[model samples]
Target: MASPTAAPALRAEHLTKHFGRTHAVEDLTLEVAAGEVFGFLGPNGAGKSTTIRVLLGLLRPTAGTAWVFDAPAADVERAHRYLAHVPADVALWPSFTGQECLDLLAGVGPGTDLVYRAELVERFGLDPGKRARAYSTGNRQKVALVAAFATRAPLLVLDEPTSGLDPLMEREFRRCIAEATGRGQTVFLSSHQLAEVEAVCTRVGILRAGRLVEVAGLAELRRLRRSEVAVELARPQPALDALAGLPGVADVRWTSPLELTLALTGPPGPVLRALGDADVVRLDVREPSLEEIFLDYYGQAAA
Candidate 1:
């Protein structure tokens, strides 16, 4: 049973996983709410996968504790009825067709209803007749996505689910997740593709060198980074390159006809005041994206 005190759908308490002297994941603690899309982000070997494995009960933590829906993750078999996983590389029986695989997994999941299976076939643009061996990496991913979405489980744990998908398919995958989330489903997403996480996740946890560096809402993370400003002036303006040195401004560039762009590390007021004499036509302020925010964190880590 789920906890009543806003306890999160998933959680890790000082979680740690070490392989002999190698610390694969260390002192990590985080949470994901019900019906929320949570992005677990990290560079390769940053312990993202290892942490996920521990959460899924695939590996026991060397130290600490983890829970899903108020139940211990080490008790996955007991909770398996409500969860589904889509790995980075989805493998299936080569001789089986896409439809066959979906049917098989749908059948294997705790329910007998095939209500969502039909929707998955259409939403993913899968050709039911195509054999698993003949599919491209993107197509294989599609098959796994179809199966996962079709399962309509309460929780989805996907690790780079769109690894080989093209932009179009990735867009479709995003739509699939959006639809699933709308129905109050919980998603635990791990990915190197920061853009996807930016587009969909409500909150993100960044892991670096086996430790949880930061975790916050996607919007909050961007706020901690910078704001992008584009100013349209009525007339030709003098070079404002020096604006880059302002307290909040990080970089400035002239982007278009009568437009000056400023990447502001803080509020836009200081940068706006710098253009006081210019006849400003319009000002557009855009927030930094998840990619930009994560990269900034990564840079800080490297430094």
Candidate 2:
């Protein structure tokens, strides 16, 4: 297990990367502790990939710096020694069998555990005898995932790692990630699958147009999201005009004589107290999903 005082597995301080005219990432600052599973979320062209490249030492920041295991990200050779990366697009030598590909990656990457590698192969259901040319897009992704998971690197940087996987495979991927974190391995996952991130990540960072917009635990993010509240009153429907004016209420609508639906964006205390005064028959509060929260952030930014 990693020591509690050990240096962060990954850290970025005011990191920025710019093209001739495009700013791919800007002043992004965050840290992933030694054993955390951190999710990096952004829509396409939101700088998720750019940030990952910077962290992997594949691209140097135009400003500021990133570090991996205390080594500067620009020092690829040293920082890479402690990390493994799996890109969204997986490409392999067509002539090499899956087993051969794993062998090659293990030899070049931080060493691998044969037993764990074999287990991953079975878990992901990759056929070792099949050459890369015969594999499907999902199979190619599986090869990279298995290889990364099997390695002994202390940090795993996965970019859209489940892009081509089906539901079952995605579940398997989450399971693997959970196991990795359990073993004290830090994971920096860049993905569009909000549910997947919510299921596996300890914390998540949202990026918008190359800037870090929000970073928080899943529960906290949910709290910031709008909740869908529906209430059905029994007989005396308490005056709802006042309910509509309650704190945190929005889009108040009367769907039926006794039913009310509203968007709640803040604490439920005020809304609950109002409902309590009525002969409430049923009250259903649906927490916002990660995707909803993500869209809300973007919607607010756009507004």
Top candidate (lDDT): 2
Error of 2 at 221 (Å): 0.9
Q: Give the per-residue lDDT digits (tens) of candidate 2, residues 1-303.
A: 233248999999999999989999999999888888999999999999999998778987899899898789999988888888999899999999999999999988877889989999998988999999999999999999999998888999999999999999999999999888888889999999898998999899999999999999999998887899998888757587688788889999988888889999879999888777788889999998899899988998999
lDDT scores in order:
0.82, 0.90
The TM-scores, one per candidate, come to: 0.83, 0.94
What TM-score does structure 2 among the candidates reach?
0.94
Assess candidate 1 and give its TM-score to the true structure: 0.83
Clashes of 1: 0
Which pairs in model 2 have colliding backbones? none
lDDT of 2 at 243: 81
Could you give candidate 1's per-residue lDDT for residues 192-299 as a string of tens digits? 998889889988999989999889987678778778788898888775666877897766788876888877775667777887877889988988767777788889
lDDT of 2 at 302: 92
Model 2 lDDT on a 0 to 1 scale: 0.90
**Least lDDT summed over 10 consecutive residues: which range in candidate 1?**
1-10
